[model samples]
Target: MYKVIFRIKGNQGNSFKELRQAGFIPIYFRKNGKDEYYVTLFRGKDLGEVKEAILDLSYYLSKNGKYGDFNFATIYEVGNSNLGKIAGGTLGALIGYYAGGIAGLILGTLGGIFLGELADIEMGEKLVGVLGWPMSISR
Candidate 1:
């Protein structure tokens, strides 16, 4: 179970259109330079495959700057925590409803869900650790 999101700059063409049409989930951002694409690794996709595909696309973009490299900013997140919202909510709701009924149930469920999503975050240590991919905020 893996998921990722990324942005790649490339030229506009039927290739991109075809990808989107085929459910690749590419969002085209119109630009003056090359083309920018904001894409998410759609659900149920393999992280390995996505990384390989992105690398291949990067090569293609470098070759054809017209259709690529508009703005070289790749934003991606890989991995997930299965101990997320559903678990949190269920546990919270059960406890709340037994203790405080409707009011407790509502508050507990909301808090649980919020905390669950936060707790669900996981980083790609393989990519950054082994592959040496730089993840930095300083511009």
Candidate 2:
């Protein structure tokens, strides 16, 4: 998966709608105060395709003069790891077995699994390897 982060100027709602209409789904969106917004989109497509899609959208939106200043920062290849889940489960089982017998063991295992999944997701997203910086698209 590739993660693309960019900043845009205008109503985020409409921009997001336009993006969806263009077949681009945003994974994350944030209001950077005022008319500025930060949008993060994830795609499994080729890097060139992703860039082209965004460029085309920016161009289309820019013509309206309501959406412009689409500045892209970096594109990263998202990484995945199962180590966290495995380690968490094992540790939880051990601790639970020692603390409260069978009941504790079961509860602890479930809790640990949940936490592990969260850790996996959070850490995995952050551990992304940089694919490359996308060329700035000028509208």
Candidate 3:
């Protein structure tokens, strides 16, 4: 299995449907801030097929002027890992500890763990809010 992460300039709702039809399972679809842009994650078996589908969709959408322009920021593969949750917990713990000492440390650790687990399940949803990029995709 392969994970493909990319961002498009508009909603591209229909295009996403097409991808789903092509067997690319959407793992994440988030609007960037208040903008029309979106960052998405899809999981599929063949990377080439995934790329071709995206290119075809973009070309068709662009030719029709349906979504303005179909430009991909980048398309890259990322490993499925639990590191996000661990990192989130660590950061949360540090922040919580500094803010509230022992009690804060406990609360922060729990909050961080929750957020981290959510991030993994949502495949960079939290990271995207911070870094403006989808770092990973999960099953």
Candidate 4:
């Protein structure tokens, strides 16, 4: 997966969280004279796939910015990480365990309200990750 950073401008109508839930990450910050945001999109590592994604992003970015009547920043490559077999299992276990714990809490306060709350938080964090919320201190 590739992690990218970009920005949205002049969207009094759309919020970051909303955009994120709609399948875009918003890692934005105020720097110099402009506001920028980030987005991470999952794609195949092949060059053909990368090029297609780029073209799609260019169109989407342009359209999204136009919705607000302002030009948005282009994406910058921040970093990349490999998701091997271990990563898949780890991620599944993490999400499932927390989800089960949360359900247990909501059903009967499994371990305690504290644990429930912790589980809720963990679930939220995982949801953010699954939803591709940009990782940044600004948010």
Best candidate (score: lDDT): 2
Clashes of 2: 0
List candidate 2 stretches off by more than 4 Å. 11-13, 80-122, 125-139
Ranking by TM-score: 2, 3, 1, 4
Output the number of the TM-score-best candidate.
2
Runs off by more than 4 Å, candidate 3: 1-35, 59-64, 67-70, 86-114, 117-139
lDDT of 2 by residue, 1-139 (tens): 5555655565434466656654565666677554544445555556677666666666655654545432433555556677777888888988998999998888888888868865665566642322322335333
Q: Supply the TM-score for candidate 2.
A: 0.51
Better of 2 and 4 by lDDT: 2
lDDT score at residue 1, model 4, on the 0-100 scale = 33
Two-way lDDT contest, 1 vs 3, winner: 3
Model 4 lDDT-worst window of ten:
128-137
User: Any runs in candidate 4 off by more than 4 Å, and if so which?
Assistant: 15-36, 67-139
The TM-score that candidate 1 achieves is 0.35
lDDT of 1 by residue, 1-139 (tens): 3333334444445345434433445433444454444533334355565545545444444444423332343434545665678988998898889989999999889888877765664333123211212222111
Candidate 3, residue 106: the lDDT equals: 94
**Better structure of 3 and 4 per lDDT:** 3
Pick the winner on lDDT between candidates 1 and 2. Answer: 2
**Which portions of model 1 show Cα errors greater than 4 Å?**
1-3, 8-39, 42-48, 55-66, 70-77, 91-119, 122-139
- What's the lDDT for residue 80 in model 3? 62
lDDT of 4 by residue, 14-114 (tens): 34444444344443344333344544443345434433454444454445552211223233322332233234444544565677765533433323433
lDDT: worst 10-residue window of model 1: 130-139
Q: Estimate each model's TM-score.
A: 0.35, 0.51, 0.39, 0.33
